[model samples]
Target: MKREGRGEQSAGPSRTEGLEEAVRQADPDRALCAGFLPASVRADVTALLAFHTELTRALAPARSAAIAGPMAGLIRLQWWRDVLEGVRTPDHALAPAILSALARGVFHRETLLRVLRAREAELNPEPEVSPWRQMMRDGAGGVQRAVGEALGVRDEAVLTRLEASGAAYGAGAMLRHWPHIQQSGRYLFPGETAALRQEGEAFLQSCDADTLPPAGRLAALPAVLAARDLARTSAQAGQPRGLGDRLAVMRAGWKAARMFQKSGEPAL
Candidate 1:
């Protein structure tokens, strides 16, 4: 695997400043990903987050809603697809930061294409209520696989295991961001976010110390099951359907947590 140290100083002043500014603008909640990765990996991950932030702005909800959700999302996806297909080059909005990373091999081109395809699928998926679930699962898998491949893990078993764990973790994170998705009138599952957060916390706590690496153990320390359970229960109070929904979410989280636990330590 490539082991380059953080090389921000080697980049041009403008590029360095832009990356730093972008990182400064990054949402703290999302920035938590840094804790899960190595320093070099964090740089790439930060670049990915910057790309996502720019993408979100470029396809702002107000603009998307104006153009209509389906059409807008398709247009955005098509833009990226065009870049992947070599039909067009990156434009100003996505060019500097996102495309620069692509050029430098921070992320694979095919993985970007997969992300666009997944977004396209989400725009018009089957089983309307949960359209994003499968697309998200596949998209996350593709990116994770790309990352693992880039890291030079050729063993198929190891690759598959890493992909699965990464996908589940990605899905869990996406579940937590449901409210943002909802603003675009794209719902993955009713009450799924709350349930996922609730159950995800539980599953993390339930993990035995021996099962997790030191980093994982430290990462899991913040959200014990009790805190999340109380938050979920409190939110659901006086609403029977809310209570039921959270229970379902908790079940899903439990399943995810168990799957992640069994997947063994991440290769990172």
Candidate 2:
């Protein structure tokens, strides 16, 4: 959901200091998860998000042109690889935190590799939507599995269901952002480019209940809404899921939307 940042900072005490300061200065949605996760796991998640945020910022057009397009995607993939391999000596400020967290969590090496593999596939010049979706589904499944494993959820059925729901949410989110990324020569999903343009900004802006389309406003609905709905439905189905956990996920997402909407930012 985020991108890369500018130049890599030297990995030193000063870099760690700066990174921590940046985390401290992050918005509530970004910083508040520390309370939701265990201390150690929270640090890992924060480090991961921070690293991802930096990556997103770097990929932004206003930053360095050297890492744009395919080259940028390669760099991002390599960064992720380093994190997965437990190599923290890179000059980038984000790598160390991610490495430290991975080390602490005993995160699976294969899961990380799976994510990188999907990313590698994405580096292709022009990718189709179905392939992109499959790749994303795989990568997201890997991450969700790793997270569930870390949380001590042992049942395969539970893990699979959780991963599927998460992937659906992720895919939908990527679909919604296709229009913006297409303008920059990056397609998250193949058909998404056309779909988003067809939907248009006007459709996105007309999300209020009064103006919502009968068929469901794909553009108007935030991607998180899809995830929340999945969670709610799962809960209602009498699955072996925890109500508190489902509510927490749903509430956090809606809260994020409310916060963004209040700030006059696009919630999607």
Whose lDDT is greatest here? 1
TM-score of each model, paired residue for residue: 0.56, 0.54
Model 1 spans > 4 angstroms off:
1-13, 20-27, 35-41, 56-67, 93-106, 128-132, 140-156, 173-184, 190-268
Query: Which tens-of-lDDT digit does each residue in 79-165 have in candidate 2?
Result: 667756756456665666555445444345565576566656656524454565456545554454454444444456544543443
Measured with C-alpha atoms, the lDDT of residue 13 in candidate 1 is 48
- Model 1 lDDT tens row, 1-268: 3435443122234544566456555533334423344344455555555555544443455344755656765676677667656678656443454555555565567666765666566555576434444464355544454454433345555444433443454445445445555555553543555655544343333433224333332222222222333343333322223354345434534544454446553433
Global lDDT of each model?
0.47, 0.44
For residue 5, model 2's alpha carbon misses the true position, in angstroms, by 32
| C-alpha RMSD for every candidate | 8.8, 13.7
TM-score of 2: 0.54
